[model samples]
Target: MTDKLKDKIEKFLAMCLKSKSEKEGDTSIKVDELTEEQHREIAEDAVAITNSLVELQRLLPVSRKLAELGYLLEVQGKITVKAGEAYDEAALNFFSDMYGGGIALSKRLH
Candidate 1:
């Protein structure tokens, strides 16, 4: 890792450690005292976790809408389970923006 990135990660770890120590009334943890391997491992894990959280946040809205659609379909008795599958393939096409437009255009061209 670049020195700048390592420095930032070290600073962030120190701040987090200080805050946690204050909350738990323990001041023994120090970022500067960590071995190089430990520090590198923590930094890598932190970045990976942050990326996963960001991806989940971005997908949350789409997932919510899909859930709502499923509920409405179930309530109306419009969807059925087949061989333990929760959703039908055709019903899911409704949520695709390109589905309707593409089908209509293809029908027109053919």
Candidate 2:
């Protein structure tokens, strides 16, 4: 999993584990409050992130989008290009393809 996706998962879990009232909410983990549709939506978002990362990795093989959003790393004093990270035509194309070959994925998420 990419760091970004891991972050999202962690955040979601934290939210789910939070209690509105330490008393009443202390009964048990109320994951049942989240409907099936809500769960499916979260799954969809995860899939989108995974697909985006896959394309990003393919566009820049030797890069590290898996750990960071933009791929600019120095190992042994060598630079690697992180594609689909810039606001250029190539990145735009990648985002478009990521969104079912249509619109661009949210810049903030990318």
Candidate 3:
């Protein structure tokens, strides 16, 4: 990685190392007090949270777009998920702007 990232990581590691105060100023953040089962559980929990974070990152944009479409449709006073301009024009335009055109219209016309 870059020197800036490396420096930041080194600084963080230094901070972590200095988080303990015991035995004549020897600073070591040890998990020796923690049981092996607890350590395994903590690692499993971390991995689960990391996986959830990855999925959330992947889904956030799609969820945001869906929320935007819902808001646009509701502002135009329609909440139904229909498939045509007959229900909500603003929602149609919101999606058409992304995909370049309406799929139904393209299928019917071309």
Tens-digit lDDT track for model 2 on 49-71?
A: 88999998787643334334322
- What does the lDDT read for residue 12 in candidate 3? 48
Report, for all candidates in order, the number of backbone clashes: 0, 0, 0
Residue 96's lDDT in candidate 2: 50
Clashing pairs in 2: none
Provide TM-scores for the models. 0.52, 0.32, 0.42
**Tens digits of per-residue lDDT for model 1, 1-110:** 99998888778888767876799999986888877886687778788989999999998777767667766776787665456554433246543444566565457678
Off-target runs (Cα >4 Å) in candidate 2 are: 1-30, 62-110
Note each model's CA RMSD in angstroms.
8.7, 12.9, 11.0
Candidate 3, position 56, lDDT? 95
Flag regions of model 3 displaced more than 4 Å: 1-29, 80-110
- For residues 1-110, what per-residue lDDT tens digits would candidate 3 score against the true structure? 99998776456444433553353487544455545675576557657877999999997776777667777677777555555534234555566666765466667578
Name the top TM-score candidate: 1
